[model samples]
Target chain A: MGDIEITELRKLTEFIKQEFDYDFKNYAMSSFRRRIQRVLDLYKMDSVDELIRLLAKQEFFFEEFISEVTVNVTEMFRDPTFWRVLREHIIPNILLNHNKISIWHAGCSSGEEIISMMIMLDEMGVADKAKIVATDVDKAIIERAKKATYPLKNMEVNRKNYLRYQGKYTLERYYKESGSEAIINPSLLENVSYRKHDLVQGSVFSKFDLVLCRNVMIYFNQTLQNDVLHKLHESLFKYGYLVIGSKESLIWCDIAHKFIVVNNEEKIYKKIKD
Target chain B: MPKFELSTKYKAIVIGGSAGSFQPITQILAALPKEFPVPLFLCLHRLKHVRHGFVEALSIKSNKDVIEPADKESIRKDKVYLAPANYHMALELGHFISLSTEELINNSRPSIDITFESAAYAYRDKVIGILLSGANKDGAAGMEAIHAKNGMTIVQDPSKSVINAMPNAALARTKVDYILSVEEIIEFLLELDKKYRI
Candidate 1:
C-alpha cells in the first residue's frame, strides 16, 4: 500500500473534476487518498501521475475510478438498534403525521435499506402508506438495487442483522434462494422508484416525509457534508424527519438550529424550521 | 536500547489490541491521570453489531472521557478516543478523526493497519504506536508503517501475552522501540505522562 502525497492527491482530484466532470475535490482527503491507492494497486501503477495519465488516455476507465471511490458498501438492517427504533418509534410517529408518506433513500446502495423499510412497513401493516424514492450517484448500483438480488454468502449476515432487529418473520421468508443468489421478492419494488441522482450536484427531486441519508456523508469533507445536509433538508417537508448515519450528527453543522434532536443516540432529527 | 531521551514531545498515542487485551487496556487507562495532555487512540477489535457498551465499560475504569468519535470529529487533548465497532477509524491531517466502512482489511473492519498508517502519515515521527495481544496478524503492517515513519513503536512482550500471535507478528514485521510486559507498559505510560508535563 503506497501513500499518495497531499499535492499529488489534489492534482488527481482536480484532474478528474476538470476532465471527467466528477467532483471529488470535496471528499475527505485522508480516505480519498487511500481509495486512489487502491486504484493504483489495481492497475499496477507506481504513482499518482501514472493514474492520472492512464485515466486521461482511456475514456472508459473512468467508471473504474467511480466504482473505487464511491464503493457504496451496505448490508441489510445494519445497526440493528437503529432499525428497532425506526420500527418501534420513528415509523409510528411519521404515520401519525401524514396519511400517505414519502421517503427519499439518498445514497441507497443496493436497496437494502429500502427492503428493510418495506419489511418494517409490512409488519406494521403500513406497506401501502409509503412511497420510496431510492437514488444513488452510480446508475450501475441503481440497477443492482432495483434487481435486489444479492450473493447467497451475504444472506447470513443480513439474516443475523434482521434477527437482531427482531423482525416478525425470518428473513428467508422474503427471498427465494437460487444456487448462488437470493432474489428478494420483487413486489417490494412496486412502491419504490430507482434513479441515479448525484447528491453532490443534483437538485432536490421531491419533498419527502422522511429523508434517510445514512452513512453516506462520511466520504465527504465538512463543506460537502453541510452542502449535502442542506440538500437533504430542502428535500424534506417542514417538520419532517431526517435520519443520518448512527455515527454522524447534525449538531455541528450550519443548519443545526433549524432541526431539533429527536433521538440523539439514533441520529434522528426533526425539522422545526425550513 | 538508547532511550532517545525517553522524553521527546509526542503529539498522539495509538494503541491497538485484540484478545486478552481488555484488562491491560483498562489498567493503562486507569493509571493515566485525568490531565493527560496527549490524545490517546484505542482500536480494539470487538463484535460488529454490539456498539453500545464497550466505551462505557472502559470509561468505568478511567478518569478521561472514553469516546467513540463521530466521523470528522476534532482530535482533542485529555480524551481516550475508542474506535467504534464495525467502522474503520483513521486519523487525518489537521488532527481530525475519519471513519470508513471500506472492505475489511485482514478480516478486520477496524484494521489496526488503517489507524496506524493514517496516524503515521499525518503526524510522522511525532506519534507513538503500541500493539498488544491478539489472535491475528492485523497489526503487523501497522507496526511496520509506524516504524517507517520514524514514530516510536512498542509491542507487548509476546511471551507474557495470553495470545502471542499478534505481538509476535508485529515483532516479525519491524524493529520496535520497546517490548514491555503489561505492568511495564502501564509504568511507561505514567512516565510518558510526566514527560508531557515537562
Candidate 2:
C-alpha cells in the first residue's frame, strides 16, 4: 500500500477504537494491513474509508471484519515432539506438584490443541482433576470450536500427528465419524470452557499450572509481545510452565530473566519466581 | 553499463529468490562490504523440514554475519538475516522480523512476497527489494508492492538467471527499476556501499 492508504488505515484503526471499542493499534502493522486489504477486497470497497463507512452503517459488516482479521489456522497435535515432551515430562511434573491442574490455552483457535491436551490428560487418568480454559479474540471461532465437529478430510493429518505423538489409542477412539464430519466425544470437553478473550487487551482472568500460547505472539509487534509475555508471566502460578511456538523465542523480552528455559528446543520455559 | 548513484534514503535491503537462487545470492553477499550500511533480509526457498547448516554455508561465503533469525529478533545492520524454512517471515515496523506459520502464499513457506510486501510497508521508500533467480512467481506481486510504495525494485536479468520464470514473472507485473545481471547486481551493491557508507 502507498502512504495515503497507510494513513487512511491508521485513521480507520482509530475510528474502530473510538466507535466500536476494539483497539488494534498494537497489532503488527504488516499483518494488519494485509488483513485490512483482504477485507477491502472481499467487500469490493475502494478503500479503508469505504470500509470504515460500511462498518459504521452495518452491524454484520463488523462481524465479517473480525472473522477475517482473526486467523484460525491450526491442527491437532502439531509438532508431535512438543506434545511428547508435554506428556512425558511437563504433565507428570505438574502432577507431582499439584493435586489438581489448571491449564489455559491462550489464543486457542479452533480448539485443536486444547482437545489434544484433554485427550492426553484423559489417558493419564487426570482428566477429572484438570480444569481447562481455551480462549481467542474472535467469538465466531470459539463457537466453531465449541461444536467440536471437524471435517472428515482433516482426520488423516490429525491422525498422522497423533500417531507420531505415540498416542496409545487410535485418534478415532475420541471421535465418532459419520459422513463428512467427525464430532469429538462430548465427554472430553467436560471440564473445558471456551471463551472470547483478547490477549492484547484482556486482563488476566486467573492463574494456571500451564499456559500454552504457541504461535499467537508472532502476530504482535515486539512491544505488544513484551506486554503479553508480562501478562502471561503474571497469569502463571509460581513454577508454572509456558510453552510457545517452536519458532518463537522469549529471549528478546524483558521478562527473559524471570523465566528459566525448561526445554530450549521446544521453546518451553518455567516461571522462576513470584 | 552506465553507473547510477545509490540513494542514501534506503534503510534496508531485502533479497528474495527460490530454486537455483543460492549461487547469485552468495555472489551478491560476498561482494557487499562487511560494513554495508543497510541491514539485509534474505528470503530464499528451501526444504521445509531440514533446518540445519544453511546459515553456516551462507556465512562461509558472505563477509557479513549470516544467521537464521529467531522469531521476533530485532533487525540489525551489517548482518544477513536468512528466513528460516517452513515459516512466512515478515518485518514489523521496520525494527524486527516476525515469523508466521500461516498458510503458505504461492505454495511456499518463507514466502518472498510476504517478506517483500512487509518490508515495503514498513520502510516505504526507504527499502530496496531485489527479486533474484527462482522457479516460481512468488515475488512478482511483492515487487509490485515495493514499486507501489516507491521502494526501489530490481530483478535479475532473466537470461542470467538459472531459473528465469521468477524474474520473467516479476518483469511482467511491474516496471522494475533495474534488470541487472548477477555480476552487475554485485557491482551495484558495491557502488551502493561506496556511495552510502559513512
Candidate 3:
C-alpha cells in the first residue's frame, strides 16, 4: 500500500481499538487488506477513511466489521484423517491417564468441531466425562454456533466427512432436519460451553487435556502466532495434545522444541515438557 | 531462441494458472535448471481436500525441488513452491510465505490475483508475474498490480494457450512484457538463467 493508504489503515485500526477495543494491528496485512476491501465494498465506501467515519458513526457497523474480519470457514470433522487419529489413538491415550477430559476448541467458529468432538465422546460412551470449551473472537458467530442449526445443504459434506472418519453411528442421529436447516441434537452440547474469546488478546482460561486450534493461526503473523502458541502451550496440561490445521506446521515456532510430534501429517503434537 | 539479458534485480518469479495449466507449467519447470537463481511460486487451482500427489507429479519433470509450502515457510531460491489448495498464499514482509484460509476471491482459493498482488507489494520491482492458461479471469487484476508496481508481467499468448480465458483477461487489463507460447516460455526462462545465473 501507498503511504496514504497505510496511514488510513492505521487510523482505521486505531479507531476500532478506541471504540470496539479489538486489536487488529497484529493481523497479517495482505489478508487483512483483502477483508477490509470486502467491508469497504459492502458499505459502498470509497476508502478506509470513509469506512472509519461510518464505523465511528454507526454502532451496528462494528458488529458487521467483526464478522467480516473473523473468518468462520469451518466444517464438521474437517480433515478425516485428523479426526480418525484423534478417535483411534489420541483420545484413547488421554483416557488412560485421566477418566475425565477437558478440550478447548480455540477459534471454534460455528462450533462444528465441538459438535464433532461431542459426537466422538458420545460414541465412546464418555459424554458425561468430557467438557468442551468452544470459543471464537466474534460474539455473533458464537451466538450462531450456540443455535447448533446449520443449513441442510451442508449436511452432505458433514456426513461424508463423518463416514470417512469411520463413525460408529450414522451422522443423521445427531441432527433433525426442519425446513432447510438441520437442528443439531441439543444433547450434544450438554458438556460444551460457548464463549466469545479473542485468541490474540484473551488469557488462557483453563488447563486442557487437548487443545484443537485448527486453521486459525494461519491468519496471524509470526509474532502473533508465536505469542498464541505460547499461550496454548501454557494452557495445556503436561503431555497435553495440541492439534493445529493440517496445512500448518509448528516447526518454525520457538515452542516447537517443547512439543513432540504425535502425528506429523495431521499436525498433532504432544506437549513433552513444561 | 534469442539471447535475452534478464535484470539481475528480479528476486522472485510467480506463476498463476487454473484449468489446462498443468502441462504448460510442467514444460516450463522442466526446462529450468537446478540452480535457477530465483524461487518460483506456483498458484494453480486444484481440489482442496485432495492435496497430495500434485507436488510429486510436478516434480517428476522438473529439475528443481517441487513442494507445497507450509504456512509461514521461508522462500528459498531454486525451489518450486506450490501454494496449498483451499488457502490464499501471500508473500510476507520477511521473504516468507504466509497461508490464509480466508474467504475465496473470484470463487477460487489460491486465487491468482491475491498472490500476485501480495508478491507485487512485497517484492515491488523485484518480482516477475506470469499468468498462464486457465478457464477464468482470476489472474487479471494480479497482473495489473504487478505492472503497476514496476515489476515485470508476462501472459501466455491467448491463441497458443490451451485455455485462453486467463491470458486474454490479463492482456485486457495490462500491457504485459511478454506474450510467449508454452515452448517459448521455457526458452525464455532458460535464457534468463543463461544471462543471470552466477
Candidate 4:
C-alpha cells in the first residue's frame, strides 16, 4: 500500500507483535500514529514498510525503538490536587486498615510517580510501612527512573507542582544540583522494586493494596482499555484503591460496578468486588 | 435526507480559541439547534491547574450539553466536547476522543493545534475548522494544516475579536474560506447546521 501508515496500521502492529513479541496492536490509533510518525522522522524512513524492513534486519534497534515508542514525559506531583487527596485521605484509610500498604505504580515513567509517593509517605511518616512496585515496558526508561536524576528544566514544573501539594519542605531539599541535573535522594526508592513489565502482554505479577496507572491507558484503544482494566481489577485486593489519570476513569470502564468512587475529580476508586 | 448537495458530508466542526473567543463560542453553542448533525469539538485555553468551573460555565449558556470528554470517550453528534484541562485531545480515526499529556505544544497542554490537526487528519476534506480571538499564534498552523487537507477554514474577523493575534496570525499565513464577525459567524454556523445531513 502507498500510505500504509494510515491505511494499514493493523499490519504494522501485527508485524511488530510477531517479530518483537510486544503487543502494540491494541494501542489507540491516534497516539500510535503520532509515536510511529516520530520514529519515522527520527530515522528518515519513507514509510511503515521501510521501517519494518529495517527493524527486521537490525535486531539491535528494537531497544532504541522502544524508547522512542513510549512517551516518558511525566513529572513529580504532576497534579497537586490528586497528590493532596491521596496523601490526606486515601493513604490514611489504607494505613488504618493494614499495618503495611503495597502500592503498584503501573506504567511508572522515569520514577517520578514512585519518588512522589515516597515523598508523600515520608511527609506522613509512613515511609517504613510501604512497599512499592514500579514498572514500565521499556527497560531503559526503568533504568533512568532508578537513577532519579532529572534535568533542571523539568524541575520548574515539578517544583511548582510540589509547592501546590503543600509540602513541608521545598522540593529542592530532596535533590542536589549538579551541572544542570538534579539528583534525587536514592533513599526514597529503598522500598521500591522496579520491573520492566509490559501492561499490554505481561501477566499480572501480584495483587496490590493500591494501584496507580495514571495517563498510561490514554495510549490504548477502547478494546485494550477494557482488557487492561480487567487485568488491573484482578491485580487489586477487595477494598483496594485504584487511581487513574485525571481524564481517564474507572467509571466508564468494564469494571465500573466492581469499584466505588472515593474521589471523582482525582479519579480514585475503591475496589468492592474480588 | 441530505441537506446539502455536497458529495461528502462534513463530519466535524473543530473551533480553537485562546482568550477572548469564549463569548462568541457561548453564542455559537447557545444558538445551534439541539440536534445539530455534525459533531462540535472545541479547544480553548484555560487554567491548567484549575479544572472545576470552565465546563460548568460553558454549560450554563449552552442549549446542548457541554462536556469535557474523557480519554477514549466516544464522539457523538450535537454534543459540545471541550478538551479537558491538562490534556491534549485528538479526534481519532474512528471518531473517538484521544487524550494525552505529551509535552506542551505552543506552550499549551490543550493545544488548539493538536485538536485542529487531528480533526483534519481524521476527517480530511470532511472537516470545518474555525480559529477565534487570542493573544497567541497557536491556531495559525492548525488552520494551515486543515487548509492543506482540503478542509474548510474560518477565522474570526480580527477587528471584531477581543484580541487579534490568533485570528490575524491564521489570516496572515493561510487563505481562509471565511472571516466573519461574531454575529456573522453565528449566522454562518446556523446556516451550516441547517444544511447538514443527519
Candidate 5:
C-alpha cells in the first residue's frame, strides 16, 4: 500500500525469480500486489523482511504462493456464446480441413472449459476424431481436471448449457450422480490429454486446429500478452481458429496481423496465411 | 421449506451486469414501454475501486428514471435503482432497497448472487429471477434459490448470451422455466406482466 511496500515487493520478485525461475515480474500490478499482500497476510508478518526470511528458509510457501497467486476463478461453459461461435463457424471449418483434428485449450483452469469442449465435440459426433491436449500453468488444477468430478448441484446447469449448445442427449444419462456430485462420462476424455504448460515459455506442440486461451492473459502485461500471442500463433495450424476472452485483444501484440478476425466482436479469430 | 409456484407480483425489477453484459442490459431496457410501471434495480459489475455512473448512462438511453439507490431508500415504480460501488444491494421488505459494504461474495461486491438471493428471500413467491451474461458461476445458485421459492426463473440462452458463463451456469443448476435470448427475454417479461395484471 506504500512505496516501502513496493520496494520490498521488488526484492521479493527478484528472490522468487532467481530461486524458483517462475516469473511474476511482468504480471499486472494488481495481481502482483494481491498475491504479495496475501503472502504477507498469511505469515502474519508486519514487514517484507520477515516474509523474505520465511521464503528463504521454507520451501513449501513458494509452491503454495504460486498456486494461490495464479489460480483464477473459472467454470465450465465459461462463455456460452464463444463456444456457440466455435460450434457454428469454427468446427465446420476444422472438419473441412482434416478428419483427424487436434485442438488445444491452453491455460485451461480446473479443466471445466476443456470438458465443455469435449462435451461439445461428443455432441457433434466428432469425439472419436478430435483429440484435445488441455494444458494449464497450475499442476494442481490440472490434476483436478483429470479427475473430472463436479458438484452435483451444477449438473442441472451443465445440462442446460449442453442443450443450449445443441447437445441432443439428456445430461443425466452422461453421468450418474452420487449423493452431491456427478462423475463426468469417461468417454468424454477418450481422445483428451492433460498437460502442464506455460504460454510464456512457448509450446512444444504445434499445428492445432483450434486454440482457446480465454481470460488468462488479462493478468499479464502487454509484452507478455504479445509473447503469449506469438506462441499461440506458432502453435496454430494454417487457417486454424483462435479464441480469446471478450475484453482481451491482439491489437498491440506483435503478431496481431497474423490472425484476422472471424467474429471480431466475439473475440474469435482465424490464423491468416503467412 | 414450503414450495409454491412463483410468479411476479410486486412489479419491481432489479438487474445487475458486468463485463460483456452491456449489450444485453441495453437491449432489454430499450424494449420496455415508456410508461413501465415496475421499479428496476441494476448492479453493473466493475472493479470495486471506482463508481460507474451507470444511472446517467442508462437514463440517457431510455425514458425510465435510472438513479443510484440512496441508503435506505424506498423503492418506487417506474424508477430504477443501480447499486453503487463497494456495496451489496438488497431488497428490504418487498418495496425498498438496502446497501451494505460487506466483504465480497463470489468475488464481487454488487454480486448478482447476493442481490438475487435477497430478492428471493424478501419477495418469496413474487420474485422473478433472470440471469443474463457473466464469466463466473455467481448467479447460478442464487437463481436456483429463487426457483426453489417458487419464483419464476429465466436464463439467457448461453448460445445467445454475450458472455455465456453466468447465464449458462444458471441454466445448468436449475430447471429454469424460460430460456430466452436478450430480445425474447424483454418480450417475455412484458407478456408476463400483461398476463398477470388481470
Candidate 6:
C-alpha cells in the first residue's frame, strides 16, 4: 500500500497495456492495487516487476489474471424491479416499435440473467420475436453460462424474483434439476448467442433495440463509464432502451442527454430520437 | 376485493450498512413474522468480491425470505434481497431490484446510499429506509432522499450502534423518523404492517 508499490504497479500495468493490447489504464486505483497485490500473493513473487516478467512469458497467464480480476458478481433476476420496469415499460415499447429485437446482455457473467430475460419474453409471448447477444469478458463464466446450470440453493430467490417480475406461470416449471444444479431450459437460449466482449474496446455492431450493460460499469472510472455509455448510445436503435445497473446513472456520462429516463428509479433509459 | 392498500404495493423495509452490520440486521429481521408481506432489501457492504454466504447465514437466523438479488428479478412481498457483495442494489419501478457496478458512491458498490435513494424514488411514501451501524457516510444522502420522499426513515441510535459513524452521519443529515435500537426498529415495522394492512 505504498507509493513505491503504486508507481511500480502503474508502470507494470502500462507495460502490459503496450505489449498485450489489453488496457488496464482506466480501472480505479484501489481495485488495481488490490488485483496487483493478489497477483503477487498468488505467484509468491515479491515485486511487480517479477510478476510482469512472468506474464510476459506466459500469455495465458495474462488472460487468466484478467479473468480473475474482472470476474463479475451476479445472479438470475438480479434487480426484480428493474425487470418489472423492463416488462411493463420497456417490453411494451419494444413490442410497439421494433418488429424484431436484438438485445445485448453485455457483461453477462454466467448467462443466468440472459436466460432470465428469455424466460420473461417467453412469459410475455414474445420469445420468438427476440434474439439476445450475450457477452462477457471472462471465458470461464461464458462456459458456465453456456451450460446453464446453477445451484439449487439459489432457486428459491430466483423463483420469487420471477414472480416479482410478474411472470404468469410458476418459475419452477422452466428448469429441471440435475443433482444440485438447475439446468436452464434450452428453449430459452435458442435465439441467443454468447461471445467475449470487453466494453472498453467499444462494440462493432449497432441497431440493438435493448442493451443491458448492468453492474459492469462500476469497474471503470468516470471517463471509462462515459466511453462505454457512448458506445451503448451509438449501438442502440433510435428509441431503443439502455439498461444499466441500478446504482449507475447516465447523468455524469457524456451521452447522458441522448437518453430519457424511462424509470429513473430503476436506472432504465430510453434512447431519444434525433 | 379490498386489495392491500396503504400507498402502493412496493411497501417494504430496506436496511443498509457497511461494516459490522450483519448481526444487528439479522436480529431485526428475525423478529418479523414468517409471512412478513413487505419485502426487505438489505445493503450490507463487506470485503470486496467475497460471496461468503451472508444471505444463507442470515436466512437461518430469520424465518422470512432471504437471497441475493438477481438481474431483472421481481421484488417479493416477504423476501429479503441482500446486496450481493461488490454491487449496488437499487429498487427499479414495479418492485424489482436492480444491481449495479456503477461508479461507487462513498467508495463502495452495494452502497447504502444508492440502495436507499433508488428505493425512495420508486417506493416514495411506501418505503421504510433504515440505516444501521457502519463506518462511513455512504447511507446519509440516501436516507435523506427517502425522508424527503415522504417515506418512513429509521436509524440505529448511534449511542447503541456497534459502529456508530454510519448511523451518526445519517442522523446528522436527516430528521430520521425513528432513532431506535435494532429491536425497536423491528417493533416499529411490525406495528406498521398491522396498522396499515388492507
lDDT of 2: 0.87
TM-score of chain A of 6: 0.91
Cα lDDT tens digits, model 1, A78-128, are 988999998888888888867998999999988899999998888889999
DockQ class, candidate 2? medium
Instruction: For each candidate, give its TM-score against the true structure.
Output: 0.97, 0.89, 0.94, 0.94, 0.60, 0.61
lDDT of 3 by residue, A37-156 (tens): 878777777888888888888898788889987788778988888888998999999999898999999999988998899998899888898989999998899998899999999899
Global lDDT of each candidate: 0.89, 0.87, 0.88, 0.88, 0.72, 0.77
True contacts kept of 3: 0.74
**Clashes by residue pair, model 4:** none
The candidates' DockQ values read: 0.80, 0.56, 0.71, 0.78, 0.03, 0.08
Worst 10 residues of 3 chain A by lDDT: A1-10
Cα RMSD to the true fold for all candidates: 1.4, 2.8, 2.2, 2.8, 15.0, 14.3
Q: Which is superior by DockQ, 3 or 5?
A: 3
Model 2 misplaced regions, further than 4 Å: A1-6, A122-128, A151-186, A251-254, B1-5
Off by over 4 Å in 5: A1-4, A42-48, A153-160, A202-204, B1-59, B62-198
Per-residue alpha-carbon lDDT of candidate 4 for residues A1-274, written as tens digits (9 for 90 to 100) = 1223555677787888999899888888777887887788899887888888988999999999999988888889988999999998999999997999999999998989899999999989999999999999999999999999999889998999999999999999899999999999888789999999999898989999999999999888888988999999999999999999999965567778999999988999999998
* DockQ-derived CAPRI band for the predicted complex in model 1: medium
Q: Which lDDT value does model 5 have at A253?
A: 74
2 versus 6: better lDDT goes to: 2
Question: B107 in model 6: Cα distance from truth in Å?
Answer: 18
Error of 4 at B136 (Å): 3.1
Candidate 2 retains true contacts at a fraction of 0.68
Q: Which residue pairs clash within candidate 2? A: none
Residues B1-198 of candidate 1 have per-residue lDDT tens digits of: 734346656888999999988988998989889998889999999999888899999999898999999999999987889999999999999889999888888889888999999999998988899999999998888888888988989999999998989999999889999999988887787778777677
Look at candidate 1 and tell me the lDDT of residue A40.
86
